[model samples]
Target: MDLTPYVETLRRELAVAAEAGGDDARELAERLTAPLESAARLTMLNVLSAAADEITRELAPGSVDVRLRGLDPDFVVTPPPADSGAATEPAGSVEPPRAPAESDEGGTARVNLRLPAHLKARTEEAAAREGLSVNAWLVRAVSAAVDAGGTQPRTAEKARTVGQSFTGWVR
Candidate 1:
């Protein structure tokens, strides 16, 4: 959204308010307005982000995100799938969920790693696609790889077919 108009309106209001105090106050307001523009934009962005989060909560399984483009924030909304609660996975699909397990059995540790800008963006996109945060997705991935002792991590297809059965008549 274009914030120029809103920021301008704020500046105008500040100027009008300072007018009551005479020339000194008016000059100070003009000087301060230039610095305050950035602060105002940041505050506005924060408000937009909070609003998007609240809307997302009310639209669970769907989401709203505020993306910054230059100085403006844009809203991106992902509506719930038309088939909502039908199988979450496509038929014959074998991708495992990457959500982090909720377990109190282990202590948490923090590690710092840096990646190229492109890789970081890709990781964020992958996490968003799976409805998980980047940290959670990374933790799940690391757990899978470590559990395999550096061998190839098992895929969902291999992990589930053993001792699984369907006991129903097929038409």
Candidate 2:
């Protein structure tokens, strides 16, 4: 399902909440609008699924019992018990394994790019011809270019610290 409407609703709600915090907060929310829209567009389904998974893990460590309001009446997902000879780790102890750096496993990170309209249209056509999603097609093209040593050398710079950003959802 297209989630643009839902995202717009969320953004409107955010603006309303910020209004309650007075002018400064409202201005900040205005500044955040573009980034928020971009994020929602990019990570629509993944964000929702990840949140549900996290909630299940927190509530029932080794098992999940989720029920969608109008979908499934019995949709339980139970993991193997620790003592059932399953390779189980403690809840929230170990981080999940990372895929190889260049592997096209999925969108582990989001990168925004700006291309000319003509270039974008051509790229979409090329992607369609190759029977690949636009993202996968772009990834493949970039990988080929990198492999062919087509990238310019970059000057080294000192790494800088970054802070976390959060969006809280309360019941």
Best by lDDT: 1
lDDT of 1 by residue, 1-171 (tens): 999999999999999999999999999999999999999999999889879766755554456778999999998776633454336544664444332343567534559989899999988987676565565557656766665565543344344421133211123
Q: How many Å off is the CA of 44 in candidate 1?
A: 0.4
lDDT of each: 0.69, 0.54
TM-score, every prediction: 0.55, 0.31
Task: Give candidate 1's total backbone clashes.
Answer: 0
User: Which parts of model 2 have CA positions greater than 4 angstroms off?
Assistant: 1-44, 47-107, 151-171
Model 1's TM-score against the true structure: 0.55
Off by over 4 Å in 1: 84-171
**Cα RMSDs of all predictions?**
8.9, 19.6
Model 2, 64: alpha-carbon shift in Å?
24
